[model samples]
Target chain A: MITREEINNIALLSKLFVAENEMESFRTDMEQMMQFAQCVADADTANINTDDTASSSPMRQDKIGTSLTVQEALANTDASCDGYFVVKKNG
Target chain B: MGRIEQIHSLLCKKDISCRELTEEYLNAIQRDNPELFAYVTVTAQEALTAADKIDRQIAQGGDIGMLSGVPMSIKDNISTRGIRTTCCSKMLADYTPVYDASVWSKLKNSGAVLLGKANMDEFAMGSTGENSCFGASSNPYNTALVSGGSSGGSAVSVSANLAVYSLGTDTGGSVRQPASFCGVVGLKPTYGAVSRYGLVAFASSLDQIGPMASTVEDVSLVFDSIAGGDVLDSTCNRDYKPDTYKTLKDDIKGRTVGIIRQFADNNSISPEVKSSMNEAVKTFEDLGAKVIMVDIPEILRSVPVYCVISCAEASSNLARFDGIRYGYRAQGDFMSIHQLICKSRSEGFGKEVKRRIMMGTNVLSSDKCSFYYDKARALRQALSNEFSRAFSQCDVIIAPTAPTPAFVKNRVVADPTVLYMEDMCTVCTNLASLPAVSLPCGYSAQGLPIGMQIIGDKFSESLILNMAYKFQQATDFMRTSDWGVKL
Candidate 1:
């Protein structure tokens, strides 16, 4: 069963700040969602292969068709220094 | 009336001018769409200009394209030249593509009028249109109910008569499920059948641009126009050219269709969806085609495998949304570039998109890759093999497009898993990269519309369309414009 705390944790992981007032409603809704998902989870895949025999790398070729200048790339960024995008340090 | 036939008759007789048709549609959009949110952007000025050109060409007796003068809408995820291609995300709300997607260019060259860009789930990540930052797109049949999505706007616009047809990308049933809910014809062509040059990637390997329309013939007509090889989409092979969809009307006296065994719990599929599938079986049998039960066990595992693979691909595809490009950029007094990337994405993307991206990132992580992503890929290949074997037994498969009718706006369960389950019936088609179409088959006990999915072998759309057309002709389901009730 989905719980208020579980909803809060999922919200945090998703980077959304759900209001405390909405937690109970979210929990209730998530419970129904879990039930529906359980339906999909019930499909039997026992005999099917579940290992990687296929290529895991990108299929994109190395040939260069288009290029964006560093200046252009960094233009829309909120923080930039010396043609590189800058970001805050996460703990 | 048959949609394509009607358009062709109008053009042949010169009874209704192309410009007049374009103007009428634009007027309809203006009249009905304020509350519908069907179209995120209606290019009235642009469409009229295109229509005038087509009219001039017809007058000159030039070899006009098949879809000449037909007005259509495109999902926001597909880029249109010089227009805002936001994919209903705040991140790219202000961004306009400098170049057009190949499919859009093909339609433009064919003299089709661009009605506008329809709304969708943010970055094509959600099952319901509610995930859009702009707003939820309401079902034209019932404003209180959802239109179904991530191609919600495209489906609703076609259902509401806002356009002749619309284009939607299906990655794990984004297009078909919405089309089913909206009670329109939605096709997810065989993988590589259509170029993905301009479609914003949700899951690149699985994404395909296809047609959604009021009828099966119209869907085929649009599909014929935009399909075929494009140099821009490397995955698409120009070598294979399937027969024209019009040819599907020929006799299929000896053809066989398959019915997938009930794999999930009875509760997984609502009574409405099951009844619709059963009715569809009867209709097929009546059409002189043999119906057989085929069990290719791989489908049972397709859902979780699809979830893992789709999320992994999504995480990689969405990494481009870091605020360094032309999209929404959040501002703060003291922030580093890294802070900006996380902050902009966190703030710009809607809740559903972030959840998928996080799930994707976690699945693709080095430590978890083997357990989730690798296993998913293996299962995908197995599913492909299963489909091939199933095809040996029967020419096609029949299933419900979705498990239930359209839910009311904000009525969806908030759990991500629940939202993911919406694609269960539709995802297997994508998993095998097979051609599938969803057509209205029956209605819920409350009278909400239901859709049946017809799946065919790779590049076998003609057969699928034929089956859908036969059913559409045999039933009253496709005749009416009115559905009248909301969930």
Candidate 2:
């Protein structure tokens, strides 16, 4: 069973708010998916070593490539300050 | 010939102008899309513009490429320069990408006409297309039923002849499931075989942009057109590509076909799907390929492993959508920037998207259960090894694309666990990062399409497509939808 506090904590970490009424159902769904996930632990992974087996992606060329300009990047937003993205700092 | 070739020949011969073909498709979409909802944004002017360009080139007697003048739709999750790419979520509902995804750019360069952006489940998170903020795409076979998703619209467009073919991104069964549901051929290429440069990220490791169409040949044509080395996507392998379309019709007589005996015999598989698999086995045997059972005891665990890992990656990938940048931004009072970001996401995303985000964050959180993600990753390796071992015995493995046929609307809602089970048969390929294709093997009693997938080892697209081609040749299963358009 998942406690409400755990749900609230993760939601905080996720930077999203769970409404007071929606918390129970959210916790329930998380609990059920988590329960389903427990099956992975039942598999005996003794033969596998997880620490040393990181998969590496190939590197692209280090040369500069064409990318979105400051204007193009800032075109879709509601807040901007002379080509830079903007946000409120404090109350 | 594939749809791409058929359209190419018509243009090459001047038998039909590109504008006429483009008009027919646009008209068909206008007539049918009200019921099917396959396309959310149709690029009519762009398609006509491309078509007119092709006509002028033809008038000048200039040679055209294979995909030139072919009308096609792209999943909205793929970024299109100056076109809205919603991923069917309110968060990016009005978001227009400033750059084209690599796949779309490749198609554009090849002169493929853009029909529109296809609808899909929000952020490619849901199993059913019903999760779309716009609306679910209805199955062309029966409008009351769902077009399986998050690539539902891609499948529906091809099935209903809204477009000759469409691009859909598959992370976990998003392409194949919808293809299976809509009675079209869909291929989820090897993970790195196709570039993921402009696809809106769902789960980076599992996400791959693939093609869907009414025939295996068309699927191959679209796959070949879009697949190659991309400097933008490092994960895309430069040397892994083989000319799959050239070898698409190659002989598979002596090749081995593998089947999971347990799944074939399991009660979870509906009677119709089982019958179809049985017939598929006989067909392959008749073609002189040996059929055998391959064992991988971890087959059932693929879904859960996929869930844990995909959600975790999605959480990280989607963190870029903070109210700061180019997606939906919230308005109103807030104390801090952090609060503003939270409010934007909470308001912008739908229920299913929020659920997935929260679920992903929980798995990655500092809680004791964060270990679940690690174990899922380890088990993922184990599963891949098991599949590799299975591959050593057989050239290709066959499995039902879904346990049953497409779900009637609301039938799969309410229980998230039940919805996840719909992906059980399809998630294994994503977990292992292998290539798989879902083609129609048969239909349910109600005439709903049933799909069976042919999975190959990493980068074995040619072998699987050849086998699928051979199977399609010998059988009269729902090879292509016969809804008014033929290539």
Candidate 3:
């Protein structure tokens, strides 16, 4: 079972903040998932070679192509300035 | 003739205008969408505008494509230039794309009218479609049950006749399982067979946008339109051609079908699903096709491998949803950008999405990558190799799409493991990167629909479609009316 501390660490790594109130249920769910994930953890893959490119796709020409204009690119954002996305100030 | 041909004949004879047909679908959607929750956004105005263009072409004695003037739904994950393309998650609830997905562009160029954006599992994560933040899309056959998901709404829309056909993305069994539960036809093309340019990435390696329709012929028609290579999606095969429509009616008299014996013998399979499989095998035998049992022991590991790999990919794919660029942003006092991203993701994502992301992050961590992530990848290759060997002995493989028909919505939503297990029967096809289709085979004792899947080797869409078409012709299960959906 995954402990609350481990759950918090995972949430941190995932860039998700788990509130104190929701941590218990979150930990419980994570524990269940880890239990289910044991199948992969226990599989025998020592001699197997991973073929990541089994479904490899074609490569395209490295040339300029039509893309979203600046206006179109930022159209969905609520905060932008000078063609740049705005975010919270970092410490 | 199928619905597409019927509509084409009507348009050619000037018996009905495109606007009239669009209005009929729009009216049905307006009346039934509330109860069904199948559509997240209806594009009545846009559908009419596109339909009117087709009518003008017909009036000028110009030829239109087979799908011209036919209204269809697109799963919310596929991007549309102006339509709100939410993946039924709070994170992207208000997001719209600046350009259309390649599939959407192909259909648009073919003059197919867009009906609306169908609801789906949040980020296409869950199997029951109940994970949608917008609310679960109920099965049209029985509103009390789920429409198998993450493509549930796409299947439901076609089942209910809310649209002539709909497009959905399948990662694992998203398309076919739901198609089975809803009594419709769902096709998942060979990996990289259809372009994934504008499809919201769930698992880049496994995701393929496919079509759901009432008949195999209609599914083939839509597949022909949206398929083929695209420059934007480099993963798509450059030499791929859309030929399902031309060979859809071809005879499958001597075709060899491999039935995996373990899938049927598994205790998890419901009696109804087993009976349905037995009947489907009999039907195939009666049709003069050779049926043989093939042993594929590694198939049982599919679900676990799928979960590990998909979650790992999803973690990376979904990392772009931080508050700065787009999607839901958390509003509060934040001392740093990191805090803002954390809060935004926690608040914006649903429970299942968060859980998967955490699982993914954990599995891919330095300490666990070799033991878990890399092992899963190796197992994936083994599974693919097993499928290749199996296909060498048989032209196609047949299996139950799901262990059971659509279960009660509340029961499924209450348990995440149950929902995950629902993909047991269908995920292996995706893992092997094979072209597979699910079509209605029979109805359960309780009247829920049962689906049988036909999986073929890579780029064998025409063969799979031909076999499915033959099964459909030999049975009436493909007809929406047989499933209690009114025409």
| Fnat per predicted structure, each in turn | 0.28, 0.77, 0.79
Model 3 C-alpha lDDT per residue in residues A14-68, reported as the tens digit of each score? 9998888999888877777777878888987887777554545566678987778
Candidate 1's DockQ is 0.24
Q: Which candidate is the best by lDDT?
A: 3
Q: Which stretches of candidate 1 lie over 4 Å from their true place?
A: A1-91, B263-265, B412-414, B482-487
- What TM-score do all the candidates reach, one by one? 0.87, 0.97, 0.98
User: For residues B215-326, could you state the per-residue lDDT of candidate 3 as single tens digits?
Assistant: 8889999998888888888888888996898999888899899999889689998888998899999999988899999988888888888889999999999999996788
- Give the runs in model 2 whose Cα sits over 4 Å from its true position: A51-53, B479-487
User: Which regions of candidate 3 deviate over 4 angstroms?
Assistant: A51-57, B412-415, B481-487
TM-score (chain A only) of candidate 1: 0.63
- Give the per-residue lDDT of model 1 (tens digit) for B356-472: 665666556566566667666766887888788999999889888888999888864546676777888888988888999999999887677898888999999888888888778
TM-score of predicted model 3?
A: 0.98
> Given candidate 2, what's the lDDT at residue B171?
92
Ranked candidates (TM-score, high to low): 3, 2, 1
Ranking by lDDT: 3, 2, 1
TM-score (C-alpha) between model 1 and the true structure: 0.87
* Candidate 1 docking quality: incorrect, acceptable, medium or high: acceptable
Model 2 alpha-carbon miss at residue B284, Å: 0.2
Individual DockQ of the candidates? Answer: 0.24, 0.72, 0.75
Fraction of real interface contacts that model 1 preserves: 0.28
